[model samples]
Target: MTLKGQHLELLPVDSPEYKKHINKFKDLHLINLYKIHYTGADKNNNSDDSWSDPIYFHGTGHCGCIDRHIERRTGSVRISVSEWCQHDDGCETRGILLQGHCREHSLHEGRHYFSEDIEVALKYAADGLQEHVASDNLSNKARFSLFLCKARNIHLGHEAMHRYVVSDYDIIPCYLVIVCRQL
Candidate 1:
């Protein structure tokens, strides 16, 4: 799906930015490195100040396959409410989550969640891959295409122990790093 209301600048592989930032992740094939341009409301104007220090990693449940990732289509690079919670009361909870009103629960306080550990983020991506692959019955060729795409596509972070819970206003997806796990 085409990204609406967002502009992603794909970085070249030989670029200094890609080499310095993306080359650290070993065993993961680079698919794309996009500098995210968020069009969402910046209540504190932190996007400009914090764009260079995007040391945090957000697990988007994407297995590095661009074709299957839905969150990338949004300007905020965030999943919609319906795509977030699948419970029976999701319709009602959607509003609360969207408004950043989920302060009742400690874990659900923020609208977005991120991790500092790349491995943890990768685990989420792998888990998502399982779910995605299981839901569909694709042929071997299709599965190969997913990995092959990772092999191609030339384009192409910091220290924190805790998970980051960002509010809707302060949340801005600074970059999009797409990497496929080497099997």
Candidate 2:
């Protein structure tokens, strides 16, 4: 189960075949557990006051939580939270979509209207991490850690890359998970 030192390829998400697979998985309401790792670069990464690392669980009827953690070496703090599944039309495809929410305004549009770019960025990061995991030669534990680290880095980089595109943005180093029911 360790991803260390394995060679993984970044799969294209825009393929028609992949979309079909995702729709099928969604229709089945399959729940999957994923480990999303992120650095504690900011102080408000977690929804809870504990300031622990942010880990999220995604599935049907799953409520996401935000956890915060502090890094010892940098003395910096960060917070991360799981996306909420609202009952509005927006909750159709983006399950627990994690991203910066509009604090002042409530836009009840579909999940597609939210931050699609962020999701795409996350996919890129995940793909990069997967590839690194597939190519590296390390212990299972080490490989897992490296995968997490790379994923976090890629996620953060995406945020930085698109900071100006979004509003009310507080870019925190974080990762996202889109688990497949079959896997």
Candidate 3:
């Protein structure tokens, strides 16, 4: 299927890529694996087009957001904007610091969150799937989703929590992973 000039290629179960990642998700049933080609502008419209590193396992509750992201290809940094300080001794600063919210991490709108660890991503995808299943009645089985992303810039902090915060065309969703819980 094509959306916003991007094409979604559904991989066959026997494809090498599927076989490569399927082992890691043995507990779940694979519904489909899609490889998305994003040819649109960066989500944030930033001119710095350098991709930093590839990150995996980004989970989202709404599938529409991915479509919207592909259509507009623009995103902004989502971080605490408090200048006077209040959140966890104030938000962490940039430079050699790697950049992240304080110990009390809070979700900021417009910011993309992800983790390098597949386990973390799986947990998030599972939670999102549960929500969808309950609200949309999409499936009786435990559903989960994971997005393989390319990050132009990544903010790593709170390693113990596996919270990777990025902003402004820094993160792009490239692959879609759909799985159902093993019965």
Candidate 4:
């Protein structure tokens, strides 16, 4: 299945093409993008060494978040928005990823705005996965995993920034995910 005039195909897992696509996604932008890897279980049979990539999503900029995990003995990847800014202090201008609302130049009176159209983001992510996977014959598990990864990546990539806020209405707690496709 194809959409938006782009032909998509799911390259083999861990293939050179797959690695290239992932790397390209990572290098797209420096803002709000985060990469996480789960090493393995600990002595207590619990996960360990799981941490967020140092790269933070800059407000209003496109970024990618990648995560790997195991559940029920199945491997999974998740990509999504990391976080959005609640303040406006030229932070968005500098493309630096940080937390907290800027009190001085409060865009929403120093309040963070949540996303309003998560479903749209989700669809976009699904489409992306479809393109990448490029095969209608993919297993449900593979498709589901791809959906999760794409959704997370889009969510994190399109997270709002202080600069994107043009009106007071843009500020809300709706949990908006980023969409890199737009970038």
Candidate 5:
């Protein structure tokens, strides 16, 4: 329940103080880290939005949509990444579409972090979550994962605070952590 770090402590999920620690950055704007496209679908309906296959792409701007519809070809089509916030008729960047969507405006408001908050929040996610899991799960008894790696590093290394905001396990963690490790 209590996570001890070099300078701070955190509370992982399933603990009482966890919610409190998560609140420190509640007001921060979250932006998309990476566009992760999941696949697999049930037999209920095959709408255009149904998941067909996993299309993982690095960097922003690229939407993971492939032409796999009933009449479309298997892999002959691609939707060019929208450089602007194409989320509701807001893609009017640089003339009529010359410069395209800049990184600042091309984020999923619901899943990623604001360009500004990414730096401050990484430590919390890396150190906070790591310590909480360590303090609660490791120090107590038999543990499955002693160290979190890669993307898990942010969540296991500390704790991306906004995770509590979206509350979904599939969303991307604050990616500025990509640039974060350098800091």
Candidate 6:
């Protein structure tokens, strides 16, 4: 009444597979199985927002509701956000994707951030870092803070929950992910 290798029915104790099964049981090997009922309209069938957030932002600020930490925690390292914002269609990400670090400009749309732009980016990164601290995951917030505290060159702000930076190495004048989950 039962088939071998693909059925849940009890096998005869005299069978060869019985020893294997017994061995597996003795070894305490746990096996889990699930039958997923996934319809094409997954959202329509069941809507859940239990795991939407993935980071938390924390630290100091001047805002009434939230802490608005300034860019320069010190007067040494400079920070700035990325050049291109709307990464849709034929955006700057297109070039970075094709040529592996922007063909024309210096990573951020060829714009070398010097004076005021650095301040803007620092502010943005600070806000972003804070958001990460107060959100869902604690590790992300810590990584971003570490990167922010140790960047040397052009500081790139958060995009899609990751921070970028132009490395100080001259040979490879490119951007690097300073803060992000290992993907």
lDDT of each: 0.41, 0.26, 0.48, 0.26, 0.23, 0.26
Badly placed stretches (over 4 Å) of model 2 are: 1-119, 135-169, 173-178
Task: Pull out the clashing pairs in model 3.
Answer: 42-73, 43-73, 43-74, 43-75, 44-74, 44-75
Compose the digit string of candidate 1's lDDT tens values, residues 99-134: 322223223343334455566666544544454466
Off by over 4 Å in 5: 1-34, 40-116, 128-177, 181-183
Q: Pick by lDDT: which candidate is best?
A: 3
> Could you tally the backbone clashes for each prediction?
0, 22, 6, 27, 16, 16
Worst 10 residues of 4 by lDDT: 1-10
Q: Compared with the true structure, what per-residue lDDT tens digits does model 2 show for residues 26-46?
A: 322212212333232243334
Q: TM-scores across all candidates? A: 0.52, 0.21, 0.56, 0.22, 0.19, 0.17
29 Cα displacement, candidate 2 (Å): 7.8
Alpha-carbon lDDT of model 1: 0.41
How would you encode candidate 5's per-residue C-alpha lDDT over 1-183 as one tens digit per residue?
A: 111111111122444533432333333322111211112212212243432222211122111111011132233232232322233343121111222112334334433221223334343333333433444532222111111111211122125332211212222211110111211
Error of 2 at 89 (Å): 40
> Lowest-scoring 10 consecutive residues by lDDT in candidate 5?
144-153
In model 6, which regions exceed 4 Å deviation?
A: 1-97, 100-110, 114-175, 180-183
RMSD, candidate 4, Å: 17.4
Greater TM-score among 2 and 5 belongs to 2
| Over 4 Å off, model 4 | 1-32, 35-96, 119-179
lDDT of 2: 0.26
Residues 1-183, model 6: lDDT tens digits:
111111112233444534433332221221211111112222222233331121111111111111122212332222222211223333322232223232244535543222122233334434545543454543432322110111223344444332333432201111211122222
